[model samples]
Target: MSDTTQMETGRFALNSLKMLLVVGILTLVANSIGPETGFRAGFVESIPGMGLIVLIGLVALLLGRAIPLDLPAFAYAMIIAFALALPFSPVQGPFLGYVERVDFLATTTPILAYAGLSIGLQTGRMKEVSWKLVVVAVFVFFGTYFGSALIAQAVLSAQGLI
Candidate 1:
């Protein structure tokens, strides 16, 4: 590979490593707060389950790092993980139930928190926005929000979940 290609590969691997760290920490925290028993022996018991998830995710990330891929490391990792998680896949027996928890939102909280902070960190750049631009941005945001909600509602209604 050229110097530029090497640098790009390193950057991708670094980003994937950071993602693994954040996601692993979040997954551990979510598991520690058991769906049934807040945080007692249940948390300790759930360690292996959460660890397994992070472990597989790490393996995927490493696999992506070892070979250049068109997709981002994490994206490729997720596809790899999904393949391993299919119902008929032998690997599914271990993580399927743990991942099925209704409160899986716990893991999402950290990701959302990171997103919010990332946007907030751009406050300096955002100051250059004109009022007109701001108004348009707000409208676009609302439009996307409403559009997604409407689409979700329609899908849920069709599935008798509404």
Candidate 2:
């Protein structure tokens, strides 16, 4: 590879690391001050869990870049995280305990905000798309939501939790 290309790659990796650290800090703050009283774990207490999450995300990003396929980093991250947290995995106990300390909603807030901002910035591109695409997106989102709710209800009922 050319020197310029290598330099750019190094810069990109550094930027990604910085972004992941910022996200970890944001998630820690959000988790510490979330609306739910039960989720008020102090910021200091949540550092290890959040750091682990960021490290996993960084590993996933690197893996995605190393692999030739077009799959996104989050996909690889999910697979890796799931493997580590599986019941039979050697790291399952500590992994789950630390991860569970990080509230799910806290992690999603920044991601959703980023998604919204990106979509907002692309409104002109979105307008260029056929209206049918919007309709399809709505239906897909609705179907996903309904399916998730149904599955949640069934699971809760089975467990006598609802």
Candidate 3:
């Protein structure tokens, strides 16, 4: 590949990595507080914006080190604004029920989509492959979350922790 192509590829990888880091950290914070409390903490306390902070921080660090701003700042700003505003709208209130919780998840989707797209693109086989890997990833993600919740509930039941 040409130098420019290599640079573009590197930029894509770096952005994807940064997005993944933000999502992972957001997930950790949400999970640590437990579901009920996390839902409260997210909307009332700005838990979703935590991911934005991490993204901007990473960008600033990259700029300080002389890395070009490959990611579009305005696009992210619009996303953040939309994320912060959508749940508060009356239309979404009836459908989602919990404005804060729904907003938090809504905000988190961009990064998750970015990560998933990065994976699907970088594999170089998505264009030729059947739906196998996509199906597998979906199942794996669901399985891990469901399995953990089930195990936790079982342990709590056995120990009377519930």
Candidate 4:
């Protein structure tokens, strides 16, 4: 379309790529410093897995922008990741092999930190909301936590793993 619109689109894409790269690096560092392995060993071993994860995120971001729907980029990423990891999928073997190198806790660490920072920054706005909303959010969080624990316990018991 217009030259200005094209320039803005290019700028947006470049910024998105930069943000994703930062996230990838942060995630790699988190994974590297985990308790199970030394930093050098973990960092070297997890490079391929982390790279694939970031690539999937980049593809999902592009897909989200290209599609007309209002779905978020993370939703697209989840779908693509899930599909790749499915047992019957063609890429399942290599996908799982690479993905398994990255610990689950490593990924959640950065995400949780970001979420906490976001909430901290929004505290002023949160104060403007009703107390009832805070109460509801507490209950929702509690229920989700308890429900997940119960499900995990049941599954572990059924599998004779606990």
Candidate 5:
């Protein structure tokens, strides 16, 4: 392809990514409403929590980009969010109170949508793996399931709650 054509394609791809992210952000913001509180009141209340999540995720992404790490952006974003949400983190002070009423079911919509988009982009490579992909997927599923169950059982046993 010509240089001009390549540049145009790159521009188009960047614009497309920006558009998708904007839509996802908007969807997450709007869907922040809780079922228990109804739309109007919950919509107003959820904004701060949603804002904090997006800010933290954006900061994480920026930090990841600044560093010379091989990890994916989402991994860093998750780690930053998780760390901030930890009990000892002073950063989570006000946000924790709002967290309980935050509509996580609504938040999953864009997250799953992006996950689908990511998987869809790898279709050809997935087809190359074929049945082996299924085997790997099954192993991943069982590993996660049983691993979590084992941890939970251990923790519960230690606590004498099980």
Candidate 6:
């Protein structure tokens, strides 16, 4: 195989390993607490989402490394997005709303950051440094947040799960 192909493969492997480590650690923690929490329904329901987020985050990490983009820029964008989504994420009642919100943030943040990082790193100059880009990024972040919510709602509606 060519050098580029080999490098890509190596990077993918490394990223996958990192993701596995993270997931393993998280799972251990969850398992440790599950018995203590009574292990009834709540813990069972939330683990899959947590796993999904970890999987997505791993993919995003690999993609980010493969691309020539700024990691910090991507992180900044995600942080901004998380801030916007926080207030709207339902965190109340008996359900583990806080855990769900955290999972949602985990799933979305990496993707958003990857996007922003790709743009910021590839472009000759960051319009990102300017106030306009910040405003635009914020809007885009909110757009994604709300758009995901709508899509999720539609899916739930179709499934009669809403």
lDDT of 1 by residue, 30-89 (tens): 655655543322444555656666666766766665665545556865776688789889
Off by over 4 Å in 3: 1-120, 133-138
**Residues 85-153 of candidate 2: C-alpha lDDT, one tens digit per residue:** 888999999888777788888988888888998887788888688989999999999999999999999
lDDT of 3 by residue, 120-156 (tens): 7668876666699789889999999999999999999
The count of backbone overlaps in candidate 6 is: 0
Give the winner by TM-score. 2
Regions of candidate 6 where Cα sits further than 4 Å from its true position? 1-7, 10-18, 21-43, 72-162
Across 96-122, the per-residue lDDT of candidate 4 in tens digits comes to 888887877788888999999889878
- In candidate 1, stretches whose alpha carbon ends up further than 4 angstroms from where it belongs are 1-23, 34-41, 63-70, 98-103, 145-162
Give the alpha carbon lDDT tens digit for every residue of 28-52 in model 6: 4444344344332244566654554
Estimate the TM-score for candidate 1. 0.61
- Which residue runs does candidate 4 get wrong by more than 4 Å? 1-8, 37-41, 130-133, 136-162
TM-score of each: 0.61, 0.73, 0.29, 0.71, 0.58, 0.33
Q: What RMSD does each model have against the real structure?
A: 5.0, 5.1, 13.7, 5.3, 6.4, 13.0
Point out where model 5 deviates above 4 Å. Answer: 1-25, 29-34, 37-41, 69-93, 98-101, 151-161
Q: What is the lDDT of residue 119 in candidate 2?
A: 88
lDDT of 1 at 23: 74
Give the lDDT ranking, best first. 2, 4, 1, 5, 3, 6
Q: Write down the lDDT that model 2 would get.
A: 0.84
lDDT pick, better of 2 and 4: 2
Write candidate 5's Cα lDDT for 1-162 as tens digits. Answer: 123443454465566456545754565565654355433226566666666666666666555555666676678868887887799999676766655445656767676877898997788787677798799999999999999999999999999998
Please list the C-alpha lDDT of all candidates, in the order they appear.
0.67, 0.84, 0.57, 0.83, 0.66, 0.55
Worst 10 residues of 1 by lDDT: 37-46
